[model samples]
Target: MAALRSREASGVPLAWLIEAVTAGFVDADVSTLLDEREERTARAALPPSFFGWLAAEARVAQAIVSDQNEGDSRVPYREVERAAARMLLEFAYRLMHDDPDRHFLDLPFRFAAPAARLGIESSLVIQAVRVTERRWVDQLLTAAGERAGDIAHSVLSASAAIYDAVVDSFVTDYVVAQAQLDGEMLATKRALIDALLKPGVRDAKGFDDLGIDLSGHHVAVVLWHPTAGIGPHLDTAARQIGMSAFANAVTVVPGDDRTLWIWLTFADDPPPAVLERVRSIPRDPGRVGVAIGPVARGVQGFRRSHLLAREYAAVAGRLPPGIAPDIADTERMSYLSLLLRDPERAEWFVATELGALATGAVSDRENRETLRLYLETGQSLADTAERLRIHRNTVVYRLKRIEQAIGRPIASRRHELYAAALLAHLLEQSES
Candidate 1:
């Protein structure tokens, strides 16, 4: 039955075969359904080099990836001679199945486990996957005969979408595994601090090593989580999400047990999504204050960004207790951080920008709060009403009051920037 299916699928694109299976038009009988004889023949067709030779090629490929890594990363590649051969055989099986019902990724993560232990960049692990895929296709072309016609047909015709999904999962697994490896607690807090602060303070060692990626761009995150029952570790939550999102190790160090300092490093400028995560974190009731540093590189970049995140945390710390957890603008937080760094200066700026409305009095503060929410709701009257749980007419009333007091149209660009600055000041205020 399986052999009959394989014969019928001979020249069909893998996509169409998979679609037929998915659409319920065919029974994929993937688990041992395929003709065993044909599967064996396909695997047998590959040259000896595609298996044993594959390891040699992987070694060279891993070397190139290692060489291209950050200049200061002294990590060395572990040998994969035996493992690469296993991966080749596995790849051959995956290629021959070409049937959606029987399709499984069969990527060689276990083969790379040795290199993974050496602290090589996860990206390097991904590079090996590409190299393996390319090698498989090359061998397929050279050796394709009647037996491999289906394998050749699918692999060649729709290489892009087919391999994209494979690589995505492969890369996702590599980073998740790296996170699991690093999830084990690191060295003492004081030791990590000293290492990060003073680069040359004694020889660097494992876990104790300057864990920061000196040349990588980073988005530093700080979580000021509540210390009550053994609720979820905010640090762990951040690490898992960061690993999944950025596909790399996001350093999570305890700033004491109640506080966590995390850094997500990237090879280049982060996408908007990364910044949004940083901004959106430290959610409600948690007093989460997040600030992302500008993209920077090297040792200076590491310290500078950490300093910004820490400073951002301090600014959040000063917020009136129970202030909604929120992120200060990454772009604006640069100077705003400086202003809020000193209470008196922040007060002065608030008083200057907000004028009479800057006083911390209840009525003035309420007006300020409305403006903050009003801006946050994207200046939409309906959203502000819904968010504040007040009638839409109440929002209109508040906006009118606010504009009358501030003496400027809320829609003006200048007033908008001022309103943001005013909120920054309010974030630093302690609720009396």
Candidate 2:
């Protein structure tokens, strides 16, 4: 009856062969055709050729089974399953043939372990092989198939990150280079302004280029040390004062460590309030001097205004430390009026005003010192002599020579001409 069932279930005439082999291991009392139908059930589930293949592959001489009476041993079902899965995977690799671009053994095989343990080893192995083949086919199909929206999204995200990094680097480099280039450009512009606005640089429409309309404005000049921090501070402060008050103003071209200049135009006669506002800005540690020129128009007019401002500032009283000197402070220096039009003209005036005294006969250095002492002493003959440590008679003789060279009577024009000559001499010394 067991043999009949095995034949019916397995459709293999040999399904009862394993039963016969197991019968020899069990005594009649222990086993009587034990569950042949069950045995057929398990074998029917396996591939038809699986047992044969296993028999051919097994290296051991004797068959192993789970039968205590016969001393035959059974391996765990899991072990058999693992072996079968591995074998089938190997077979698939051979079938596909090795190709550099293809991956035949990629999928994880551990999942087939349970199926093998259920005595369905051949089916699990074959299924695993089919799974690996399907994966390869899917990969190829994706390449040749319709575009996946997700792929484009992933590519765009990566590209965006790369682009951001590249742009950030480029901007950083550009800023550094721009900073250096800007400094150089500023220096060049300052030099050009200095030359064109100087006491003597051939004048042209340069002021027009600077955005100044000389026709309708009163110009004033301010000079300071470029390195003193006063220039930038003044600029910042002035800019904060609202544009209406200084619509067409021009900052001075920075000179060396000691000098800088600015030109300002007021629509109306600058009120005391405006002047005071400008004067109020803190100055550098030294005596901060400023010059205000009479209002002038055009480039030539601006040049004149610059000179006058400089003259006024120079003759002004000893400026308080950190306080800018202004033109109003120098009202006492009457001689500065001569140079109020042009510094170059003042220079010429010095040569002419001192005439013979300016000649090669008298050392200009000695004469200038004598004049300074004379002025300091309030032009008193006795006091002038005392300061120079010379006899009064000698002072008298020098004064006469001075009067001769100047082509004027010291006693008559003493108040006017002497004052002019004295201021010119002072300016010459200060400049030197």
Candidate 3:
């Protein structure tokens, strides 16, 4: 029966098949889903590595059931936490069958033992499962595309049983495991972070315990590296930030193996030396990525600055390695990051705004630099020419070329032109 269902899924209409073949639909759905409150809650609970891990697990489960292979797929199980996750996912996939083999029913028990030892909270486990279920439903519906409305009910109906069984069994086992270990610290951190990030009243005592003064100015910084073993490096960088500012900073792991959330607090706005220290953090080994948010004051500022840091981090992740630091606190990046939340949209905007110059050829890049400098210097031809060490006629000539490519007078769409050119430069840098 499972085999028949799997075949039916694969043998869908051509359009459906086309949509299903690429993971882009799933990626898009996941991105959209992350914007929701519940998804954000779950995202906050897990580490930055969770999304990539979940995607890999989904692929492995799909491979197992579709191929009817009891043996493990190629996904790595080096981490015990992920090994437990894989087992539970496999059990869920099996339950989709009319007569699932009962042997794998003990999977929840297996997951509980290690989870308890690792001090994993039951609520977090449930939230993770719930988020995964959401993704699964979205993947099915997205693959259906135009037929999504037709199959949405059926997909939800079929997934309900699997989700319920998994949750019930997990909660039951987790209750038993909780008696054996204390995960109170993890729970406390999770609650504190939720309160800090979410909209509502906050407990001042919580901040007091962490030595964070809510009334002080804060500059949020997010540091992450591709590899998991960079925790020590991140710690060193965080300390350096505090030292450079001659102030205190609070750092949170946020449950991610590869990321750190930090807020450096000051009695006043950070001075030039502190900003310079932040800009130099990327020079550290391990290729650590740093995103520094603007300095702001009080509780609201703390939250807002962290949010901005997350946004900056998102934009930085897309840039080529060597240039991420150069964009930190740059006037152009601050302006462009606000508008480039969606990469696809950014690409389209760039393509439309800078027709010929967007091609990223040598001549195109030279013209983009000329235009950027020209705008940066208040549209002064002399200043731009001097910056480029070229004749003023050369600057004017390049402006004419830019105007021709954008099909408008530069002054008419100066803001759009500047944004598009800057973003295009970064995008091209990333491509390299």
Candidate 4:
């Protein structure tokens, strides 16, 4: 017993005893076996009570360890403490049972003193149970922290990828939408031009539609943009010049910021003073030019005049920004230069013979109708008379009147007269 106690106190291996219990070694009585071994060692090394107490506590701890491994029961703190206390009481009995000098009650106190020296308290068994739980909780917290960090990293990466994709999509969509808007704007501009440039659009009804009273109109004004602000400035000037009642105007946006095309018609030959009024219109920051076109009834005659005005404006390049150029001034020379191969000789003839009449006695309105009828009839007198709903004699009279006014006979100078008639008609219609 004394030898067994020394070995147990020194923390010797006790697995054999536990194995003996597990293998059903019934003959291995723990107390009897230790008693037999006591004779071979120093008996006074430990009191019998202390040896018994140590052995009992070892047995209880083994049972708890076995229960935990088997997963069959939970070792509560209180139950562990109760089992340890029972073992201590058994030890006191074993030691004091043979002691005559000390009362049995004193042995328990003596054993407790030594138990405290071994760091065993009434609450120690409870603390041992809690130590296991603490270790488990620490391991769980470590794993959670690692997993949380990994999840956060994944989320951040995903968010960055999603943000980039969204931005790319937004840019693509914006470009597509802008292109669509530009296409629509272009379509609108084409529609406006078609409506304004079509033949006969400037008829009496056309004038009325534009809020003009064209009952007696005989001439028109055509303005072009040479720079920015020309359109707005011309609009203001037109209104100031009684544009609302006496004239009808249309503005065509040519998609060039530097240019605008405007057409204006007058109830009668505009006073010569109105030219200066036109000249005084505010200029753009850059150069601008204006050209007058002959005015005639409705939009039919107005188209040719407007076109001629643009042509003259381009060729002369003489009008200062905001200044109006005399259409009559460019008509004779510009037309002769364009239509005749011998421009210089033709211009000379016009200047010498027909200049006064071309610029004077041929009222823009009548001359435009005469040429229009002539052209529509393919230059045939009978056809012109029938188209004009007049007698052939009446057509002959008008042709004679045209010849006299032009100071040349149409029959003698077929090509020259035809070209002159066309140019004169264009100028007359524009001026009207």
Task: Give the TM-score of each candidate.
Answer: 0.41, 0.37, 0.49, 0.28
lDDT of 1 by residue, 1-432 (tens): 364366446653332322222232222222131236533453455433233344454565556555556532544333332234334444444444554234443444443344455566666656665676676567555554454565666665434444555556556766676666665424554466546655443323443354555566766666666434223656455654475546344676766656667677777778888766555443454533444556556555666677777776676666665452355445656555665567666565666666667665777776777787777777888987888798989888977887787787777744544555465446545544
Error of 3 at 266 (Å): 3.6
**Candidate 2 backbone collisions, by pair:** 252-261, 252-262, 292-309
Query: After superposing candidate 2, which stretches have Cα over 4 Å from the reference?
Result: 1-171, 174-208, 226-245, 266-272, 284-287, 311-334, 337-432
Global Cα lDDT for candidate 4: 0.44
Candidate 3: C-alpha lDDT: 0.63
Q: Lowest summed lDDT over 10 consecutive residues: which window, candidate 1?
A: 24-33
Name the best candidate (by lDDT): 3
Q: Which stretches of candidate 3 lie over 4 Å from their true place?
A: 1-187, 201-211, 226-229, 267-286, 330-332, 355-366, 377-395
Better of 1 and 4 by TM-score: 1
Q: Write the per-residue lDDT of candidate 3 for residues 60-97, one digit (tens) a residue.
A: 54443323323333322223234334443443334333
Clashes of each: 2, 3, 1, 20
Best by TM-score: 3
Q: What is the C-alpha RMSD of each candidate to the true structure, in Å?
A: 16.8, 29.2, 24.6, 35.7
Q: Is candidate 2 or candidate 3 better by TM-score?
A: 3
Error of 2 at 371 (Å): 15
